[model samples]
Target: MKQWNIGVYFSLRFQEIAGALDSALAVPILVPVQSSHSDENSQDLTLKQSVTLLESLRSCWSEDVLLISCADKFLRLSLQLLSRYSNWLSSGLADWKKGSVSSNPGCEWAISALPDDFIIHDINWLAKRICGDYLEGILQLLSTCSTEVLDLVKKSILHGGKSLSDLLPSVINTIIEALVDKSVEDLRQLKGITATYRMTNKPLPVRHSPYVAGILRPLKIAGCSRWRTSNNIFDRRC
Candidate 1:
């Protein structure tokens, strides 16, 4: 059994999992749900399914019959999966750049103070849920394994042994800042809000600001509390 895990079968399974991640995460995830909501998410679930497909092999260790390390397999496999997600995000950010970022100079700072723009809700959710929450969870899972397994898996990925502080935070920040840049770029109607007060000499209306509300509909659909953007990923709080 250990031989199977350490040899041809393991290699085949690893390729299959990498293929699964490509199939699942490659397309542009255009938008999140519009109305109803559920905690059961297919994106993260796809990641979990890929992990469990191999993690289940841990059964071999219990009988003292396993010489292979499941931890090594898990780390490599998880990195393979995240590589797919990171690629997809790279594409999105690139596409956004061609159409959005070059036009805006303050992209680096805009993400720090972006409005609750709806166009980027899906991007926001993925970065927050998958990269933020899910990656943290994956790290915790690795902590359960022996250091030998962790050390071995490091060779499987670039910067696999470096402190996350030295790597991931900047990458995540760039993607988010790009998304925020796109969101802020879409605020064409913003001038109209002030125009209503400037053009009209009539008394101030008591009703809620329609133009502002229209701009915030994405927040309404996604929920005000659910939306969050990071000014500084280097601060390690996304």
Candidate 2:
């Protein structure tokens, strides 16, 4: 009975820890992502801080405490926070591509902080940065966990509830939704090509569509330096 009460006490303390996570998260998350990846500040300090906090806590907490209290709550919070930021970035990029980025409220901050090196990037640069090291740290941290810890975390989850196992995939889906959409949108040029050919009564060439190259350009430029081999979708090639 005493041991059970002690476990409960730790669990409740963990609840407090989880509760405070949002406020700690707000400092980095609520800021504009463009500023986070600006010329003067190439490093996304916001993202770095968030990941560091999670890693710090994971290291600081005992495995037994984590198993008892189900630290996967932190994973969920991370997903929410990253999704919000990623979605904001995605929307902003879409706006920029459409030739209408809204005025940045952080202009003053940028001027004051950057003084001389304040440079806002185009949609292409921003997307490349994200696909580069900005999100690479996040993916590596989220995906590279011990199998034993993962199984324990999974078992600790409530029945029929999401476990830590889902965090990586959920994050990949949410964060990459922007790139995916852009790639799909590139396909619209094909309609223009078909229209042009139909007007001339020529059969489409057997050669690969240049639109295929267009679709792949951003991804190829993004260069999968830190975005490869993290996905665990094992399948038979045979």
Candidate 3:
């Protein structure tokens, strides 16, 4: 028997994360839907727009965010369900994989926040299998947009169990390679710096924590106004 070891991490502030996301995404979604209600033909057109916007917003979120640490109960539960879902997905016999847990409230927040979109009534009646299908479809749509998105799909698969940093370099490299047209030598240098810093055995620098905080800020947002004019990664929208 092949044992697929999934190292699950649980983290606190899960609701806080969800709350921040809902706040950021909900309003931009509502406008198109509200405009659609006035006329029949225009309603249909606006409704489609609303659906796309909502779907995109929902799809933008990485499920991996919820799985950040080993202490999160919800994350553990989600993974257990996902493991079953993945197995079912791999099985050709099953038309769909069923998740024991419902992530529908997240989906509903997405849907109600954009009501003009066609409301599939009785959504509650759909089997867990169908919800899995919905998530699968949403992820599939996101995968086509950029190398960054494709790397996310790859991580979701390979990340059945792994440290987050273990995946960061590959993803960053993919984004840079696909969007920036960087050469292999440039990439190797970047990866080398990341690995040396991350894997070093030293006690860490006096500025280590802040240095990490600094690294997280997108280069353009880091107040190098001079460089922003020439290499505006912020505008790239990756």
Runs in model 2 deviating more than 4 A are 1-24, 27-50, 55-162, 175-177, 200-210, 225-238
Off by over 4 Å in 3: 1-16, 24-29, 33-72, 75-117, 120-130, 134-238
How many angstroms is residue 152 displaced in model 1 relative to the true structure, after the best TM-score fit?
Answer: 4.5
- The candidate maximizing TM-score is 1
lDDT for every model?
Answer: 0.42, 0.40, 0.34
Model 3 / residue 202 / CA error / Å: 99
lDDT of 3 by residue, 195-225 (tens): 7768887664565443344343444332353
| Worst window of 10 by summed lDDT in candidate 2 | 229-238
Candidate 2 clashing pairs, residues 3+ apart or interchain: none
Where model 1 places Cα greater than 4 Å from the true spot, the runs are 1-7, 28-78, 100-209, 224-238
Output the better candidate (1/3) by TM-score. 1
Candidate 2 lDDT, 1-238, residue by residue in tens: 4356655665575456544443443342223223323333333322332333333343324344443233455445434433443343344334434444445321222212211101111222333443444334333443556777655544322211232222334434433554566688879887788788878978778898878888876566445522321121111111
